[model samples]
Target: MKGKDHFLVAGRITWDFRRLSEEETDWGNKILFLPAAKNMSMLVVESSPWNANDFGIPYPTYFHPAKDSEVFEWQERMRSLERKWLFSFAGAPRPDNPKSIRGQIIDQCRNSKVGKLLECDFRESKCHAPSSIMQMFQGSLFCLQPQGDSYTRRSAFDSMLAGWIPVFFHPGSAYTQYTWHLPKNYTTYSVFIPEDDIRKRNVSIKERLLQIPPEQVKVMRENVINLIPGLIYADPRSELETLKDAFDVSVQAIIDKVTRLRKNMIEGRTEYDNFLEENSWKYALLEEGQREAGGHVWDPFFSKPKPGEDSSSDSNGGTTISADAAKNSWKSEQRDKTQ
Candidate 1:
């Protein structure tokens, strides 16, 4: 794959980067292929947090992209929908996981008069139902979108589809994950209540949402509604004519990225050297002044475990890859291929 313009779209599956042989990994660094996988690399478009070479993409939502007329019609309908609940949560509470704040959020929702909680577990079939989830979002002014098994969630887009402002608990949830589709000024479309605040019970989700003036909420919801077209995947059977959906945005960005990389390579520019690849996350957020601060708030979510640790779970609930395990697996695969 070296020096080739290859693009791999690992839709929804977090590609185990550990599965790459050492030679393959080296090739990945030198080449300019685009891997739309969860793993971070020099040229990746992922649903995970942004890195220097990794651009962010939105997770696929339930609905297909629509034409201008259909999009506008849906926007109007969302605007007209009656939101009876101030805030709502539709997820399972990770009770056993002490690090997770989901249980607290669920408890708060159940205790609050204006909050709606759809406690989803093995017994709850409603959580899996798109119609039921949409109904919950439509009836709520804000959707509590804490990190799921991963940093990003399809529910965030689902809430936006219903014109409900998403209340995120972490930057990775949306703020840094959808640069192409979401507005840079996060306040214009969504609310950020730090995960720490929820874990520590420092803020009330309902009260904080209530604190936002009705006028501001109106504007935020409208902003989210307007972002609908860009965040969706267009229907493959037909063309969208003028509007660009998620696929269009991602493809164009990837092309632009590759073009720049090719230009840099031709000119022998070392801007994207191996050092940058090792600390891509730092460069990705350099503009945000996190480089000077030495780290980011989401660092723990992506950091590897220290030596001799249990390694069963990290901060993000065992979503990350173990380097040794990945290397061994990659070697095994290489041996199999040779055989």
Candidate 2:
């Protein structure tokens, strides 16, 4: 697929995923979704969560009623997010980012916490290829699928392909994908938890996940292993569009999606320039306002200066809050912190 210059994205926007915690934790909902490009052959996806299991997906997919949603509000939030996300990421590298969830999860699995539970020694557990990653996911009984950036992610594909049941984190996400044909409980194939219920109901997400019946997990594994060959990107005769095309004629129809994406990459920046030019007045005014009011004030993590740096200086002389500064501010281990 990459030979045809296909832009296969595997992850979602990190910024948006963090935004979900701001929403209500529990709600049931659905959404209607349609792709922008033809056949969705250019930019396919498989963005599951780290804790859940998702198998392989090599097509342009969108979750209607989107992710990080507990109610109709999630649907609306996803609609707004999709435009800036999937379409806008037309030319993004195929989830090759160093900080991807897959990498972090693999790292965690080798570390002391999960490592001791697995009863296995860490083998450095690093894989240089996507296949290796898939193998790692397959070797396990349950694959965790955590929605990155407001939706379910690649972990779903990983689990389904490996015959592991996906342990879904978001409420109202999985069943909605199957048009409610699939069971939401551990009976049919998967397990899910409403995000808000974790803290309010005194639920231990990991404990509950570990408690899934072994028989149910085996059934889910069967479903996934059977589903993999058809869904993953591995077709020489027909490219990797077989599974989607099997569903509909429109699925295989090719558009100049890649070319258009490259073009947008050029055009989008120009539009941003025009927008900045249009709003230069407002930006200038805001800059002036910040100049007058500073210090450990309201915008500590972003607009304000660093704890030790001076804000008055420009890129060279100034001490601004860089991206590294923000990441460095986290004070605790995320799993140990109570909601």
Candidate 3:
């Protein structure tokens, strides 16, 4: 940890305080956080760590992943100096929050801001980022997932959920991580003009969405309507808890994982060894490796690796030496964990 400069968590520190469960009385040695937090500064706590998006009555415990899964393994490999925790206090926000992010988006669109841009009231509008997000795939055409303080967020899943397509602010942010499942022209979905371009022109962000093709706009709207069957989960079906079933399931899963980890700890089992076994979060390891190798194979940076009339005969069927190394190690433990 000292040498590698990773997240050094010393003790039970509160990471996601908004939806912490009552059953999760304390921390655990392991937890599964969103992919957005994978490479960030973090720590291991003996008490249970919280997944902010998941919560509800009777608890949605089934879908929570294990601490020793691909997600947690990535975090475990990160190295950082630890910070100590003390005097823990706890409270969670109220449920069915009309103040939730999606609700706010609906409110904004329902209001006249976008319809009449220049005359719109920007000062009176409040920002609508809910502390704990539920998937917005069902009712919304575009799941307005701009960056949250950094490069990525789980809103990509919201895109996948509705297939409404993501509207990214940065072109090179991790949408490729979503791959072909992403709809056509998702680049159009995201506006990539530099921030300087906006400041110099004094453009409002909403005005840009208006310029996108009308056909594409209609397609995004239609996609959200279609995703209703796939992602608008109301499985258990109780009235007051209308949209909360899936969120409940997510919380329940975290509670279950924490319970198992704590029980194993008390019975003298180490979760760390299990933590090492999971290493699959690289989801694009082979693709990235091949891309790197292709660059080097003809690399203007190098000499012999480049192809030539004689090189075809000198090498194996014209495949560069870099190609073999790339394919062989595309799946090594070090590559998977640290790639």
Candidate 4:
């Protein structure tokens, strides 16, 4: 619906047929969701820049419950608890993918005396509880965070909730992502080790961690703990007037965006309509040739097709060509002209 209702979405959403049930799709327009497969309605909230760029939508925060309630007496205990290990990592191995770095980190932790590996498969009933993981974070100086399945994971935030500094292996793991939630000065509360250094044996995580002074570590830990309340999502039924949590920040962002959009539309309705016609993925999915090809609507990858160019088949059933293919084609044309 245009200019009337807006939708806010969080978490990883996919448009795979196998994941959808027959009943879910059969229901009429009773349900509204953030459009998938490159549909930007100006009403959707995305997860990351990658998702926003791919789908042409605004990004939103992935909210998680604050562990404050679960970890009773955490403030008093965390300050007093002796950190037994230099660093700790608690994640299962993804043996299926050789390129996955979790397996390598597990191996390194196993060999190093300072590294503590708390390996468990969440698929099993016993390993499902977050208590063991929280306890490990409480007893460790730094919590190792490697990107798993996606660029970001809930573990990094969880480690911070326990007042433990996070060590990231990839820029996508933290630095490049979560701009709205995390500080620009990443070193204030987190550590970054280039994945290449770990793979090349150029850096020792244990040695690097040990190099940090106790005072600096204490400061970082304090900052992490202070950030916990903001990063968390409290109960909606309770008053959130004073507390500016992630959910609050995300909702505010959406409101600002919608306000600007509505104002712009009101001032120049014809121009705005034209812009939407050029950029909107506003079409019936079942109807053929309704969607623009080339790329996702409003995405930079899209450009008006050239003379004599024709539409082609794609996996998405859209006439869109891959960005790389378009780049190569443009290069070929330039070379031909030069020749």
The prediction achieving the highest lDDT against the true structure is 1
Ranking by lDDT: 1, 4, 2, 3
Ranking by TM-score: 1, 4, 2, 3
- What is the clash tally of candidate 3? 16
Q: Which candidate achieves the best TM-score against the true structure? A: 1
Q: Least accurate stretch of 10 residues (summed lDDT) in model 1?
A: 25-34
Candidate 4 segments whose C-alpha is farther than 4 A from its true place: 1-5, 13-48, 51-77, 122-126, 260-339
Q: What value of lDDT does candidate 2 attain over all alpha carbons?
A: 0.33
Off by over 4 Å in 3: 1-112, 115-143, 155-165, 172-174, 180-196, 199-201, 223-339
Query: What is the model-wide C-alpha lDDT for candidate 4?
Result: 0.56
Model 1 stretches with alpha carbons more than 4 Å out: 15-55, 272-275, 282-304, 309-339
Write the number of the candidate with greater lDDT, choosing between 2 and 4: 4
**Residue 259 error for model 3, in Å?**
34
Local distance difference test, each candidate: 0.67, 0.33, 0.31, 0.56
TM-score for all predictions? 0.78, 0.36, 0.30, 0.62
Provide backbone clash counts, one per model. Answer: 0, 32, 16, 1
Superposition error at 328 for model 3 (Å): 36
| Candidate achieving higher TM-score, 2 or 4 | 4
Expressed as tens digits, the lDDT of each residue in 1-339 for candidate 4 is: 253335435243122111223355431121223334233322222133222322212123233434444333554566677888889888777675444568778887898988998886533532345777777888888999875554455678777777789998765556544555676677899888765566556477888888889899999888887676666666666645455776776567567655765676677643122233333332211134333333433232223345566532211112222232223334433544554
lDDT of 3 by residue, 1-339 (tens): 112222333322222221223445432212334454343333221111112211111112112322223223322321121212100001111123222122223333445332211111123221122222222232233444432212234444434333344454332233322222233344544434332333244344455665777687655544533422222223343322223333344344445546655676678964333232112112222252232212221112112333444422321121122222222223222433542
Q: Write the per-residue lDDT of candidate 2 for residues 267-331, one digit (tens) a residue.
A: 77321222322122122123322422223211211233446765533221112222222222122
Of 3 and 4, which scores higher on TM-score? 4
User: Residue 204 in candidate 1 has what lDDT?
Assistant: 81
